[model samples]
Target: MSYVWTLGEQFEGKLRGVSFELLARGKKLAEELDTKVCSLILGHNISDEDLEELIQRGADEVYFVDDPRLADFQNETYSNVISDLINQYHPHIVLAAATTIGRVVMPYVAIKVNTGLTADCTQLEIQPETKLLLQTRPAIGGNIMATIKTPDHMPQMATVRPKSSRPLDKDPSRSGKIQRIVLKDELVDTRAKVIEFRTDDAGFVNIEEADVVVAGGKGLKQAANVKLVEDLAKQLDGVVGASRQAIDRGWLSYPHQVGLSGKTISATLLLTAGISGSIQYLAGIKTCENIVAINNDPEANIFGVSDFGIVGDLFEVLPLLTQKLAQAKK
Candidate 1:
């Protein structure tokens, strides 16, 4: 009846990184609140295979709904299951990853439950006075961090981007109970058909998975300079990401852009070359473990978040860094 946090488990045959990330956060939140943490897993007859790993992820209890309709991720079907589960159990706080599936389903679930959600949040805290969720996200790019809340909601919901939060040290010793939830006919519907599932090659080192990412902004000055960043990334064995400006300038594709309106990534190490680190750009990639900033402008905002900074022309610095890291590797 009284749980501090509920993790929305996203299963792709196995538990995802975001799911473990949420569990790690939930475990911390639950300890702070002196309450239990639970995870919601929905799939068709996956109770035996899926629920055990969730238990190992620091969950006090795993609430599972085994149904045929949940075989694939259908927005309506997924949202309905989540919405119904929330109404039935009524947990205090719900946290979902801002992954593509979560992006599609969380808002719908929140709207269905008539609750406000903080989208693409980077930080989360609890109000010490009232023990309420303080959801913080990037506003107007990555320039400003905004904390939000829903005053008139039962279970506060927040959707966090991947790698924003660190996962807990895995403990196979942590064990819990798995409760199978029975889904009735009302929860079953067919608005769509999933004929073929094609895995889109997420491409060279998914920026989200990269320990280090080298990103370029409009300051590259010309489309040709994007290759400089790419070459550097190749040397560093890191992925190449860009600001929306670079993509809009036709220097890069939308998939490579990192910003409020772009892909969200948090790497252990991130390098910003020629980028101004506008708030929107920061909104997407600010949670990096270590940031290296390179720009000619000494007043650039990237210096604020970067662990190390190089104030020099990128054209000079990139090739040198690339060559230096390359030589060191050999």
Candidate 2:
């Protein structure tokens, strides 16, 4: 049977949250196409419980490659293995997270399999009549959203944005087949070797995973004023995000940037201070549940998408808002 395949991602022997998110999306597309949803993962010493969790989430089948060499992500070895599997199994569609590993490996695999790939896709749907995968993503620097399809390719491919969708609740009764794949020496061997992995100690919460994000923009005027944004985020037990302008000014690190070229977030509450929402900035936060904008201009673009708007000087408004929230907690 044709399958909607999702490439599962693992880090340090644990599956990343995006893996389950892809499975959820894959399940929907699979149902629309009348196919099964399959998950493929490559790692070293991954537990059977984790493999079973894939089934519980949404995967109807799980294929995993377990080897010490597969633990750290190597571009050539991973791409070759995935490409070979696609050629052998001939899945109807393939989905992967648009992460660092997925970004590096998927293009190579798509080229090897001779298929087009849509990167950073925000939405996916199966065309009713043709069963083609419709990949929707921001185009022209996030000014427009384009829907693309690979009509000629055997297996359609897409790298979905992380946090763009939530995972299905785990169902303990769900059952699926689990298969272990053993590859030849040549497929697992690669010239490139990972010397060591270094983690950045930036001392900031991962905004993509944050439930609440307080963002600042150019209107903050100076880097010192960014502390207000940080303070408010702390009050809400959340992380701080920034517009591209704030990042450009060196007020915040690139990791804190939210926009077309930066990270996409799906926070429950996104509070923006002094940000005039550009289309690029809006695209990143479109999935947020509630948006509150604090800007002096009543016609600020941010107010248009905001659930609540405060038209006043954020310099004055933020301190009072922060004080009130703190008092409420006390």
Candidate 2 has a TM-score of: 0.90
lDDT, candidate 1, 152-183, per-residue tens? 78788888877877777766888888888887
User: Which one is best on lDDT?
Assistant: 2
* Model 2 lDDT, residue 178, Cα: 97
Off by over 4 Å in 2: 202-205, 326-330
Error of 2 at 191 (Å): 3.3
Candidate 2 collision pairs: none
Relative to the true structure, how large is the alpha-carbon lDDT of every model?
0.79, 0.91
> Over the stretch 54-138, how does candidate 2's per-residue lDDT look in tens digits?
9999999999988888999999999989999999999989999988889889999999999999998989998888879999986
Best by the TM-score measure: 2
Model 1, position 279, has a per-residue lDDT of 76
